[model samples]
Target chain A: MLTYPKTELNKVKRGTKRAVYDVEQINHILDAGFIGFIGCNYNGKTITLPMAYGRIDNKVYLHGSLKNRMLLALIAAKEASMTVMHLDGLVLARSGLHHSVNYRSATLFASVRKVEDPEEKKTALKCVVDHMIPDRWETLRPMNTKELNATLVLEMEIQSASAKIRDEGVVDEKSDLELPIWAGIVPLKQVAKLPVRDALLPKQLKTPKHVVTYYKKNKT
Target chain B: MLTYPKTELNKVKRGTKRAVYDVEQINHILDAGFIGFIGCNYNGKTITLPMAYGRIDNKVYLHGSLKNRMLLALIAAKEASMTVMHLDGLVLARSGLHHSVNYRSATLFASVRKVEDPEEKKTALKCVVDHMIPDRWETLRPMNTKELNATLVLEMEIQSASAKIRDEGVVDEKSDLELPIWAGIVPLKQVAKLPVRDALLPKQLKTPKHVVTYYKKNKT
Candidate 1:
């Protein structure tokens, strides 16, 4: 299995047991979610913002308006990091100190650059939209020249990455196990409800096959 | 309504219509979620990590092992920022450019300091645990002196804050309305399953009232 080299930047310090450096595992964590918290330095303080992203191989794509401050800062700095997490469950323990959460999280450090080539930019945009919902870009209206010009696309070539996963039952002190308090795991899931069609659409138009498939796979 | 003053640090530049500065609205966004993405500078590169947080008025609390590198970085910086977001739905549009998510998100810039007072430290820790689930701290075994001392608690006093909310339906270009593509919202929700009791717990001990209440409120 391919794994990232543990550097000072991507090493997990506090929870060494939960730390993961394998590339496949980190990619799995990233592919499970579409939104990522992107960190950038702004006015001497680091700030994070959520953005939709897509991954192909070792590169992640991000797009926004040309005037986006955070994206501009990233390009100026030439390096960036994004983190994604999925909360699986809540771990309740007999003691307050032992309480924890079941989660899988990944952080990627990458070099940032603008996607200037038109064809590459278009492919990146499609990758991003398709990442949100598989086969979504095929049915959508194609981007016009004006729209394409106004958009800013960024390419992040991942340099180093790490992941952490905790998927276990409660762990409490030996003495606290016999306490009268209840303890267990409460599993959490992000599910989808029935789709609501836009009022502008014709009543006769039906939901597409991809939409139905996504709903079936994601619904509670 | 009380609103945070517009400043360069917390200003929302792109989506002016979705920007919210009202204190009550921002607090509502903060209270709806427990995990926040905290940004910190590491070796000249900004990194974001998910951390459980609790908010009391304008102050946010975070705790971890005393040796946590991220916590120590925040203390060294003396100022930090956190971003919390709740994804509400997937907004599929006829044009890929219009595709977006219905969400409520808040970002806070704060001055950070380590909590040294014993009483305040205990209170902050309780707040952090209780924020995960209401009334959880009261039922769990209290923390011992060793545990308390081994923990590092940081209090972030909010200096500026801003929120963005988008709860409306699909907004597509007028020309794309005639297209046959599917357009609408797929509502997303984070829900809890039935609690699983720890194997060590006596079969006689029942799930607590707070856990049941939390489940009832969050279940699909």
Candidate 2:
């Protein structure tokens, strides 16, 4: 069982009991979501924005316009952290203080670099697209040189990471447990609805296999 | 409509066309989700974590244990930024460069302060719990003085904010429209499933009205 090195910077302090450093567990959390909150410092203020990302082994791929501010700031800092979370359920506890949401979250601290090599950049773009919907990139039009030049691709090598997950029923104090109060979990999920084909698409062109497969896999 | 005063801190740099500063729009985005990505600096490294929050007017409420690292850091800095995003769909385009997601995201810059007043602290905690599910606070067991004292609550007065929303369909190159490729949206939504009662719950106790209402409102 591989694990991320425990360091001062990446340690989870508040919920030590729920914190996990196992590499496989952290990767599972990352693979569950495509959008990640990337932390960046701008003019001495820390801000986080959700960005589309794809993870491969110890590397995470991100792409944006050449002038994207967050990407540029990360590139300048040479270090970054990304967090992904999936909300599983609402823990309705007997007491207000114990109310919490069941969730799986992972935070990765990494060394960042720009993917400037053409072949590597292309592969990274493909990874980003495929991360969103499996096998959809193969159906898309190939990228041209101009589009490639206009885009900026970044690769971050994971150095240390930690994941925290809470998936259980409500926990209430023994005294309060006997009280006449409702306590349970309300499960939540992100689902995909029916796909809407582009209006400009040819009437005869049915939805592709990859899109249908994605919908089937994601729909409840 | 009221708007947040735009400055370098809250300005949306990329995709400026989608930037929204209207206060109502930003609040609408915030109210749609309870979990927000809060960015904090620790030892010169910026890290983001997902935290449950409650919003009232220009103020956001968050509560955690006293030793929580992120909350403590935000208090030390006396300022913080939180971002909330709702992913609407995947915008699959014909070209790789045009791939995007339909989402509504808002970032808020705020001044942080501890809610030391006992009354205010109680309200903040109630707000945080009820924000997860409406009318939920009344159903929970009341908190004791000791419980109240153990919790740390922070009130962030929103100073500036901005939102970016992309709700439209795929935008592909004019030349690529003729290509025999699939381009469309797979609408995504976070929805609630039926409530799961705790195993310890008495069989005679039926699900509460508030819980049923929440499920009815959120279930697809």
Candidate 3:
């Protein structure tokens, strides 16, 4: 076993590419992401949507109008699979044949239940807010009864899951290495700029330092 | 009734937030993502994983080692639902109550299936390569039979879907306008850096500008 056995996905034989299995590495990838692509089937059509979500203690918490048909169907099905991702960079191989992407991603398989409990729902909301900005939940107003009733929270109990990744760059076959082609990685990054408050906000309101530091993410 | 009716979800009522409805816009969001988050249920233990994927026309293509249990489950399910996402930026509101994120996201319903045809799988790979780097596909070498066989191709048909977004900063109720708060949108972006070739790649290889100038996605 390697020093990082938990992070390896395929241990048997990786005929082509090696998969990452480290949970720490995976968590790093998740925190770096701001959104996730939601995939599911309805009336026989496969539809994909990008949505906002949060990760807490290994489980995923998502909220939208309870009326979201896709969320309804998946929760109704009681079972769904979601793919969350962080695109690290683009892989450039010597030959177009070997071209690929350098990224870190994950897939979750779990049973979902619509969160109905008032306290649990509040906890879930706090998880999301804290995920967006660490410890921001305590600094903001707690969910009033009205706001809680207005939204539906769904909890996906993550069961069996796996993460696959293609990092580094093209490893041309021994003979193909001689080909004259640029081969390497083109990095990708997500950056958050300075906070912009709402136009209608009270005149006395000012930006918080955490809000400013929360935006430390930027392209290198 | 609103100028941006498509932005609102259909299930939302008059008092709810305004959401976009154009499915085409939703598809555009799908194309913008580099990775995905998968939620699934297996053996009752819920788990989530991130993955790399490509959007070609109305289909989403995701591949990995066929031996992967999670992917096998998707093919086995034949039809399931998932969410694909790209987070554009964070929206900072003046009032903590009105705080929200500025994001472009889409949610979809889909039936998952494994791509069987060899030519089709090859094409999917090409599409994936192109999706990640645009025109760079035409510049690369063709995939040989072995490379094609090593990868597992799963295709999801993009049928009925919805794209929703909140692009601006804080939207406080009219009365909240008098509150003194800094409010505006903090822009977010996905950027690419100069390409780096592999250490062993031929020295004659030169970087192509197209590899660097493809469409930039706004991801979380």
Candidate 2: tens digits of C-alpha lDDT, residues A49-141: 999999899999999999999999999999899999999999999999889999999999999999999989999999999999999888888
Considering DockQ, which of the candidate structures 2 and 3 is the better prediction for this target?
2
Report, for every candidate in turn, its global Cα lDDT versus the true structure: 0.93, 0.93, 0.62
Query: Retained native contacts per candidate, as fractions?
Result: 0.89, 0.92, 0.62
Across B90-148, the per-residue lDDT of candidate 1 in tens digits comes to: 99999989999999999999999999987899999889888888899989888999999
Per-residue CA lDDT of candidate 3, range A1-220, in tens? 2223432222323333555545566566667664555555544444455555678756788877757776787787786656666667877775545656666676555578899999999888777766766656665545678778877888877654556677676667677766565567877776765555655555566666666667663523
Candidate 1 vs. true structure, TM-score = 0.99
Query: Which portions of model 1 miss their true places by more than 4 Å?
Result: none
Kindly indicate the candidate among 2 and 3 with the higher lDDT.
2
How far in Å is the alpha carbon of A78 misplaced in model 3?
A: 6.9
After superposition, candidate 3 runs with Cα above 4 Å error: A1-27, A34-51, A55-60, A65-83, A107-121, A138-142, A154-162, A201-205, A217-220, B1-27, B34-83, B94-98, B107-122, B149-158, B212-220
Each candidate: chain B TM-score: 0.99, 0.98, 0.82
What TM-score does each of the candidates earn? 0.99, 0.99, 0.74
Query: Given the true complex, what DockQ would model 3 score?
Result: 0.40
* lDDT for B201 (candidate 1): 89
In model 2, residue pairs whose N, Cα or C atoms come closer than 3 Å (at least 3 residues apart or on different chains), thus clashing, are none
